[model samples]
Target chain A: MSAFSTGAVTLAPHRVAAMVLRYLYLLRSSWTRLLELIYWPAVQLLVWGFLQFYIAQNSGFFARASGVFIAAVLMWDVLFRGQLGFSISFLEEMWSRNLTNLMISPLRPIEFVCALMIMSLIRLAIGMVPVTFLAIAFFGFNVYGLGLALAAFFVNLILTSWAVGIVVSGVLLRNGMGAESLAWTLMFVLMPLACVYYPVSVLPDWLQVVAWALPPTYVFEGMRALIMEHVVRVDLMVEAFVLNALYFSAGVVAFLQLLKSARRVGSLLQTGE
Target chain B: MSQAAEPAIAVDQLVKVYKTTRAVDGISFALEPGSITGLLGGNGAGKTTTIAMIMGLVTPTAGTVKVLGAEMPRLRYHVLHKMNFESPYVDMPHRLTVRQNLKVFGRLYAVEDLDGRIAALAREFDLSEFLDRPTGKLSAGQKTRVALAKALINSPRVLLLDEPTASLDPDTADWVRAHLERFRKERGATVLLASHNMAEVERLCERVIIMKRGRIEDDDTPRRLLIRYGRETLEEVFLDVARGRGEAREAAQ
Candidate 1:
């Protein structure tokens, strides 16, 4: 018997890497897809950067910390790209009617998820790097100046995005392309709740409770604290990490449950546009 | 007396119920190693659903499916690497070149010396000419060959094929059937092919299992089915079964 004949399902790193390689091949093959990764983020940065420039000139509060809006925009892109990176990679398989092929392969669902996460990171890097540099060049706002705290913000926000991505993927698995719009629109539902632009205090008392429950809210609050007060809120970072861990776990459970349901319904064979 | 060897595939009381629809209902069969069994059925006859269950892609509501002695969808990992499936309905990523798609599947199966394997499959499937072309750009016959190459990349012992030659031309379809026979003969592989093409089934399958509305209607060799149904061709038998004629008119009397 082969090594895989064991009772427990072992995670094969090579299979995960192979999935990542597949996505990379697809990304490189299409010039439009490659350009798209960098396109929207750059535009978002340019628009928000100039808007912040105007506000900073007129308002004393904005003038005190001119990079705040620009920083927020860049950070938000990390979450957006991270979620899109994972969900779109999955949607690509469905769009091509390849989900059944992948489902039947030796590659496990967990391995597939890991590959999506890694691809999310790769895509986030490609999309954000150029735009972050543009923020420095055009608007004198270096998002990297957040220094070591930037790592915490990224990890926390990306994890939250993966949580949302997995949940959306589960819906798509059960509902096919009909629910694909959740990939793009679902994140925005969190945007207001996440308090992406303003602090949690800006929300009404009742809504602030909902905002605080979201991991991204903690990251944004932490970001503003660092930029404005120049004091890193280690407590807020810890809270974000803890909430992210919970949500990520829930996402995995929800995905596996939906996959099981799909199999029970025999949708695995029929999933596509 | 010697005990019979374990079958390559064993299904006992296999059933899958999608809500109120019984996609596969309480069917049973065993396929010996190195055997090619054609699963014949109409559109809603559960052939694809059965294949999906065996591949561990779909969970059976009841009954059990064992592939190479491993129970499906639970212990599938034990045998997944040793089995592969292909169908015209499923597709590979379109933008990736044939060689790239092969390479990706090869790595997914953790095949040793993937480049050598890809080269051999390209040669065998006559894919060398268009190995670098995007898969979407390939003709239907070409795409079928590439799908076969992908399915065979793992050198699977158990192969499940669904309408493997559905859209191919006569020449290409015949070529594919010949290659499949050669592969089975050389590797001692077991194949469970589900197809509507009666001629292909008669030529390739040693045994055929006919299903109707999630139940097996008949199980026998092509020659026997012809005699049993009092028909000159398997297509006639298929039509009779599909049209709700259970047995030959004289036999029913």
Candidate 2:
């Protein structure tokens, strides 16, 4: 390589954001990958919507069950996709050894974590629009909270998923590709246990404690409070917000630590690539 | 600094140990820029280990690596866009088409007039026909070309290639070398090539460094080493260094 007194390369946050937006754009442009994220969850929503309609007739909530359920499904659908985002992304870079190349770049640990979170948020955001419309048309799903609950759910979904996202990244960094699938299933199982729709009080007291322990439980409750009761429930939102931030912040710190460690391992094993 | 001067790449008193074994032990060398230095050694020769450290992908246990005049794993990023690397040890995404892969990197590199850049590269590398195909479908040689294209996307200042032309046929290999030579001439990028192909290195590299068991054993111009070691050509000289018979030259020196 010849030498040049080149200009300094500055790392721009907006550039990183644009890179993230482009990834989201790619997801939107690709029908199959986008569909994959929404399809199965959409099916589950449809089946559950019909079943709820049969069980609760002429009920004000029943008439609106489909829409709310669709919303709930749309909200929860992000779980798998977001977890997949956290898990599979690292594997892709690692497998390609692009991780090595990227680490060498101006992209710092914060940038990496931030980019992943942004990607997940974008997946949840764009993918929800069509599912929302589909639910409204097909099953007469309740759109009562279309404006507010959806927005609240949007913020909460991103925050909580980030919490889960932190844990997932930790797992992926520790193990190779092995923990990624487990990370996916972890969310699939945890959301239901978190009682995304029904309140934790409906469950046994011990299970309720477990539900309260999960960040999704707070988010779901915050959504229900905003939609069902029109109450601010600032306490719940504050708690959920703090918890999500804690999870994400801690995850980022841990991820950075993992990265620092990974660099050493990468230095040793990631050679020659 | 007197004789062991201006290494295009340098590692000093390097040491990295896994849970059990020391992968690299006190290895050091500096490569002069504008040269293709070969880092040759066996599977666990610490060749890859050393490269990772230089790339800032791996943190050294106790050592320092300086690449392109910056202490690496720290200032690596400042010089990142100026450098590029390719290795058969790493694979590209199979699901994405070659053009898609190129686009992603092209954007990341912020290449000017990205479409035009990709078009020129696709043609220059003879990758036009398979550009739209998924990378998984391409023959090994084609994959190497795409990887190389990605490496050159930034018009790098430092190029580290590990077994760069491994899977290509002789014609394509020669073509790749010619393009590399052109890039070096035009861009003045420093190149450190690690390969098993002695002929490729001899043809492309102005200087060479051979490693056995994680330490540099021979550092010289390929032609002088060939004649000084009393070998007809560089390839034969490689066998002597690799197989433990080239030590006599070091002792004589």
Highest lDDT among the candidates is held by which one?
1
lDDT per residue for candidate 2 within B137-201, as digits (tens), equals 88888888888898888788788888888878898888888988888888777888888888888
Which pairs of residues collide in candidate 1?
Answer: none
- Across B119-205, the per-residue lDDT of candidate 1 in tens digits comes to 999999999999999999999999999999999999999999999999899999999999999999999999999999999999999
- Total backbone collisions, model 2: 18
* A80-126: candidate 1 lDDT, tens digit per residue: 88999999999999999999888888888888999999999999998
TM-score of chain B of 2: 0.89
**Candidate 1: deviation at residue A248, Å?**
0.7
- Docking class for model 2 is acceptable
Candidate 2 lDDT, A196-234, residue by residue in tens = 767778999878887876777876776666656666666
Compared with the true structure, all predictions reach lDDT values of: 0.92, 0.70
